[model samples]
Target: MPMLKYLIIILNDASVSFCHYESAKTGKKEAGMISYDNLNKAVAFALKNNLKVNFLYPRFRPGKKYEKLIEDVEHVKIVPRKLGGVYSDAITVLEAGDLRKENKVTGTENIILRLSSPELKILPAAVKEIARKGGRINLVIKDVENFGDSKISEYRKLLAEISGLLIKKSGENSIPEVNFLTDRLMLESMNNCDAGITHLTVAPDGRLYLCPAFYYESGENSIGEIRNEINIKNRQLLELKYSPVCRICDAYQCRRCVFLNWKLTGELNTPSRQQCRMSHAEREASGNMLEELKKKNFKGAKGIEIKKLGYDDPFEIAVKNRYSIQEFKNFNS
Candidate 1:
């Protein structure tokens, strides 16, 4: 239950969407939705579970009372640059930027710049700027479900370009690692989105969500009530071992989101087309980055070895009897 070190604390009238995930759905905006009681309880839960809390805030400011409660613990607040001066010391800064605008601010240190794929082309220079800013950028596809075979070629080219930029930057005597490509390069095992396996979300309404995405999509999506008891049916199904494709897939940096799995495959553990493709795209980019970095003699990549696989998606390899999956090996330990 305390497997995840990071827990998102939703503290907003309109929760700020992170670079990679959209939390709130509809146009619901009303500040102070999370009652003080819930705040204290969440804080208590995080302490009891030893999870690091990350708070997502609304566009508007919070009352002093709310601010005091949020500061009681170490946490992260997702806020917009439009609401600048809200907190200079924000644990993680998220910007609501178009692909180009996201590019402009990509260099901010320790910031999450969210952008869609189509917008990426408009700001071809954003990747370079991101390298310049020494920031970590995560590319979030606004409409990942819309991805198709038609886009694969373009996506690969984009990844190659991003890989080139990362390689070029790493040669410049500084670290400007971008999540889409660089993360996988430095990672050895599959680093997937561990939603039900490691962490669970406590919505504003006190229901348990797999992650922030489910809470916003449909309130009917409540898995259970945390206050009552931890009652997620077939909880093992949420773990990686249960996922046929993902367990064997080394596209290790993929989010492998449970919600996206449920949406596409009608199962929590199984991944959808778009999710796998998006992840594989990133994985391939990372692979290329690893090779490019080798060419440039990057040092952080020392002693890290990314396995070479002939296939992009694990599904393909498994379908062809290439390899088997063993899920119990969570390497976080």
Candidate 2:
């Protein structure tokens, strides 16, 4: 049975896609938006299946017909900051270009700061400012695979600094939610993006995809069409528990992005060194932050603990143990 919890409707071909995988190479074409007929069908699908809709917007204002179609559904609007109405939506995603604008952090119940590694190093103050306004911050690093040694060090130091900032900003009583660092502290099980498992994307082509990146990167690779049923071949592979390394790993906050996995390792279940190491660093940072929060006697944070691990990458440990993927299945079983 397909547990389709989210219906990610891409309004146009040029809609703002995911921050990391959607590079300049995947620029806009003149292909146009999803047909109003397809939009209505998708919305009907969401309503019939009880799935929440997340509408990805284009840079320009949509026409009245399209706007009216969008208004028919109770969906979350995902728009670029320049398009305005960031304050009213359930979530706001910041592209790297959005950071170039003037600092004006006033919007939404949640804000996703999508930055490259270099951008994150200088973004602590901005993150703190955003937190001051009381909206949750989800910091998404676009270029995770390209993190050199210096960049890795900078990431560690930055997390430490931001953890303290969050502590101070929330005072002694509260813990402000910062996805990169603080999310791991509270997560007990894998709280990954769960792309194909819990969510699916519908591109302007009226095709169903695993996620937005799959559609944005290549529409020809669609799993199914909106007019018919969704056909996710070997769909079990998309779940976290089916992942050999991820099932045993305790880095719960890792997005385990299926798109990133397929992009780097040629398999949706297998993760790259960059993903594992960066996630472990954040996990360790969360551990340290949790300890400090406990020391301050913060409620609900007292019993939380992220264990210390020797190796950052789980693949290295598997190699050391001479462990095969099959061994992981048996071990986890």
The candidate maximizing lDDT is 2
After TM-score superposition, what is the CA distance of residue 220 in candidate 2 from its true location, in Å? 2.4
Give model 2's clash tally: 0
lDDT of 2 by residue, 203-265 (tens): 887878888888767867798876446677998898766776887788989988888889899
TM-score, candidate number 2: 0.90
Query: What clash count goes with each model?
Result: 4, 0
Q: Candidate 2: which stretches are off by over 4 Å?
A: 23-31, 320-333
Full-model lDDT, candidate 2 = 0.76
Assess each prediction's global lDDT (C-alpha) against the native.
Answer: 0.66, 0.76
**Which candidate number would show the highest TM-score if scored against the true structure?**
2
TM-score of each: 0.86, 0.90
Which lDDT tens digits does candidate 1 get at residues 1-333?
336676676665366776345655433444436777787888777777777777777666667888887787777666655454557766344434433344355324566556565665743465676667666666556666767876766888888876676666675334576666777766777676677657677677756677878877788887776553567779878776666677767776777777777877888878777777777777766766676677677777766666566665667765776342332454222
Model 1, runs deviating above 4 Å: 19-32, 91-103, 172-174, 322-333
State candidate 1's TM-score. Answer: 0.86
